[model samples]
Target: MTEALATLSRAYRMRVYPTRDQARLLAQLVGASRHVWNWSLAKRTSAYRERGERLNWVSLSREFTEYRRDPERPWLATLPREPFNQVLRDQERAFANFFAKRAAYPRFERRGGRASMRFTFDQRRQQVRDTGGRWATVDLPSLGSLKLRRTEALNGRLRSITLSRDSAGRWHGAITADGISRPAIHVPELDAVGLDAGLRDLLVIADGHGTRRVPAPKALASKQARLRRYQRQQSRQIAAQMRAQGLDPTKPCPKGVRLGSSNRRRKTQQQIGRLHAQVADLRRDALHQASAAVVREAQVIGIEDLAVKAMSRGMGRKAFRRSVADAALGELRRQLTYKAGWRGRTLVAVNRFYPSSKTCGACGAIHAALKLKERRWACPACGTEHDRDENAARNLRTEALRLIAASSPATPRSGESDARGEAAAAVGRTGPAGLSTSANREPTVAGSGAKADRRQRQSRPRKTRTDRVAVGSG
Candidate 1:
């Protein structure tokens, strides 16, 4: 029987050039959206304060409609209903995230940051087509047809198109689409590997055959001097601009006094923004290339989940902030995760506290006194000399294989051959289940005894793909 394909959602972002009239309209839409968000938040907070009742999207939306009809607010009536409605939906999502503890309370969005407005309409009515020229246009609800620089053809079902203005004063559009491609099926034996990510060597990989190392691009480091020069110049320009307007440079801007924007200041700010964007682009490109290579080679891959947030804290010289920031470890892991999921592969992040470096892979002996600078060490138990990163990669592979073995229903019983054990390990490697450990043993799930769990696994039928465990350190 053929396997059913899983559909994935994808988004494409591109630079957009708007005419003078369209630019005005876009600005109006952004302003209207911000107003709607602020107004809805105020109403919700007031209701909660007075009646101890929370106002949901439906209530806020109803109030929004009522407010639009008021003669005092004629500008609200001029704004497109769809984008304005999207503002309410965005706020609702924000509140949901806050309540769920995924994010902090939704603050009112200020105008000067990145300005964006998402166009909303029924999918059946939306039209996105290429003009065969250098441009393409998408039909928005109230904005009509908007042209953009066409590079690739827009495929799949259109979900939404968002127009945004960056801090550098450039406008761009992003189109999100769904049901583009099917998830890939991975071959276990050829596609199972382990990774060790660090500053010295960006990634150390260990497949069944051997190991390979990928060096860090150090994009940020390369451009830091240039960026620092630009930043210093921008700071001087800001202070001078503030002084010209008779405002205190060190103190905050007065309550209602808005500073005038000069061409030179704007140009300087844009230069800084461009440089920042260049470094970001380079870093992102490098990560994508590295991640794509890893995913293409391995279906079941294990990596360390480093505590980047904690590591970035403090001002110590040994803290290695520049290395940590330049490494972009978190971003690398994030790319590997979603890409793996999209391709029907498994990407496991080992527990942060797992001492892959301290534990000897050959003898399973823990060396508590091993320091970071000691790149190589000799194990006392087995008299084996181990390269720090290489040993860690091998241990990660072994631990990952063990995890795969424990999760499999077909794990070899006592007296089983090593070859069959390896095959049994291969069978379970492509599943979502991941391995993590404090020592060498597998962490028990729930409260079931190991014997009872083994018996249960032997008795029960195989589960569907959706029922399988998610890829993460349990």
Candidate 2:
């Protein structure tokens, strides 16, 4: 096991920026690979329906090899043997993944765009040498020497290499290697921090160190506007071109222009695609950095598991939902999980039901009613004045610590159980289900109880008048 671990530890990925000629070769490889994949998929789907039996990679490879021997199947001649074999393997893996419920039914790969090819590292044939520059030189079969940017030093035995091109026409090499596994850090005993994720304030982190606000980048909004404008312009150009070609503008634009058409529309479309890519890159970079920082600093992090899908209701009216989606809270969580694993930090998810807002952090008192507009409130229980967001942050940290301490195997020290019990009690009181009954329990006139209740119910805002009447009658 240790020997296997040692072998695995040495592998790492090196992204190579290929030259123009190399980029063209990559495109050919991708196209060939996708063609093979689609052909195999069609064959397999037909066979599965007809024969009621599954085809393995070895059988498919053998079949393709025989098919390629026929001069009549001219397209088969264009397919590279290595990429063809890879496509068969990819298909088999896709089927396996489908059975495991990891993914949906595999789709046919399209040709002529972003072609990817894979090559295994053969120690005897391939040599990896440090160039003393930014990238290291790796010898590839037939393709010869390729320089890849070494983001990190290569560690273990190289297993396989996959070459892919992004939409931006950049080549990337993903190298899988074997090496020793680093020991994961055990959940540490340190101050817990609460993060309030929002659009305006990207993150409101509150801990013993005090509250700090991390605002969203102003550039993101600006870039989005530019992207939208460019996309609209591209659409207009395509429509104009269609009109010039005597084609219906309302219908889908024909692939490739008429024989004598200008290239203006095609160039405009490319410009729009580049702008879209730029915006995505900026957003992704910002998310990675922000998530990394959070994982590095906090021992235990607590964040609201907001149901973004549900929150997106009424999104048509306001563009706020779009901005929130761009914030990518889900992506933040994903990065934080892996980053925490790499750095040995703990990320605790607080329940969506947890009322960090309604509960007073200082006195542990639950407010009978707290609205979104009540940003500043004075806690009746402790006389502590609180800013809603900052208060929520504090409560999150407190709740997270309480949860961790309870879940720990070690017995609580003197007074620890008592403090935990009080925190738990408070949580039960302020939680969503717990507070639902509070509205019904509001004061009523003693003698005129029915009428008072009717008046109170009518005064309370309801989604419909029928609902108000139903509650009033009850």
Candidate 3:
């Protein structure tokens, strides 16, 4: 499909500078939204537990509106209606996801968590106005046109605006738009590749070109000592402050602790938060660069559908396990999945239970006795020594090729036969016949509109910013 014709939903997030009063208003809106969510969740839980009745979004919203209007909670009326309504809609979505078995039960929003609120636009009443030259203003309900640091032309039809605050007290605006123009596609050199993710190596890729391993940065591991020290100091300060206030040091801080003025405890906590953010940023940067590199090189990318949560479970090799979790394997997979789609590439996920590690690549021998520590071993049947990760990567490639061949009947016979034989050999090494990899049974993760005022917007020449990247770098 052509770039303009193909429909796509995209989000652009930029740092927004709200005035002092506007910032206070935004904080109030976020607090009110959190209150509404928690109240709705409590109501839903009560109804389900008491009478086995279900409370849907609409009913909860209607009831909550009346509650807000009541004299008991007159302060709710001070908040904007749009953000409050959006909160209810989000709560409804949470409940729907829970019912569909995609997520756990909806939980109450905490006070000190990441604060955010989304506002839908009614073009007739309010919309984002571009005040010319890389500057635009979003007309929030209570807080008038908040200035956003725009770096690109907002061409598409605006859908919603989400305002969020990071842990470091910086506010950002994420604008969702539809029918954004996509760039032209680039044909890559390699047709297919298979990746095996692990703690030592973030990913091991086996492709037609060769095998490549991306080492994990271990960001959190590298900064753990510093983080622990800051955390310990923060705890000590908080306990001492609590005791100075005539409160028990061992017990929880008295209510309204956070409502107090700035102190050493708060500053220390901020330091710890900044460290955590730094680690997260490093990990994200590494994943994005690696995933983009892989996606740019291969058209058909195959990755194991790992149950990272299951892998992280248990107390075996705590440090190693923690490193695996910190590697953010699932996040990498998620990034690859979406990036592949955007770049017009195919991403195939191998079955999680598939023994990519245990099977032999050279002779297709199944090393049933292979332990986690056995990084290299000789295939008992074929007598070929193999590196465990390299073998798994090769097996993943073989299985992926077999899957592609089975799906596409017109593929070359020699290539198909090679993949089939290698795959069958790997399966045969496992046991007997009928033990083929379940490529066909890949688990499908239970995973818009708008035209424009014609050619006027498209006819405008694209602006190339010399000083900055695109607004939506992701």
List ranges where model 1 is wrong by over 4 Å: 1-5, 183-474
Off by over 4 Å in 3: 1-5, 188-474
Q: With candidate 2 superimposed using the best TM-score fit, by how many Å does residue 105's alpha carbon deviate from the native?
A: 2.6
* Model 2: residues with Cα > 4 Å off, grouped in runs: 1-14, 19-21, 72-80, 100-102, 112-114, 123-126, 183-474
For model 1 the local lDDT of residue 234 reads 73
Counted clashes in each candidate structure: 0, 14, 0
Estimated TM-score per prediction?
A: 0.43, 0.39, 0.41
Per-residue lDDT of 244 in model 3:
70
Ranking by lDDT: 3, 1, 2
lDDT of each: 0.66, 0.62, 0.67
lDDT of 3 by residue, 242-306 (tens): 77777887776666775243477678878876776665566568778888998777766766654
For TM-score, candidate 1 versus 2, the one ahead is 1
Candidate with maximal lDDT: 3
Cα-based lDDT at residue 182, candidate 1: 62
- Model 3: lDDT of residue 303: 69
lDDT of 1 by residue, 72-175 (tens): 98988977898878888988898899889999988877877548989754766657777777688877766777888866766677788899998787789888
Cα error of candidate 1 at position 99, Å: 2.0
Candidate 2 structure quality by residue, lDDT tens digits, 1-474 = 566643334446567866676666667667767767888888888888899878888888898888777898675575446666777898899988987999998887655444678877766655677888777887765556788889887666676778877777677888877764555758554556887765455667897779988766778667766766765776677677778779897776567856344587677667766765665566557778877787667666766543334443442313433434423554454455445444445555565567888899888898868776677999988889998888888887887666655453223243543343223222212211111111111101011112323443566553111100000110
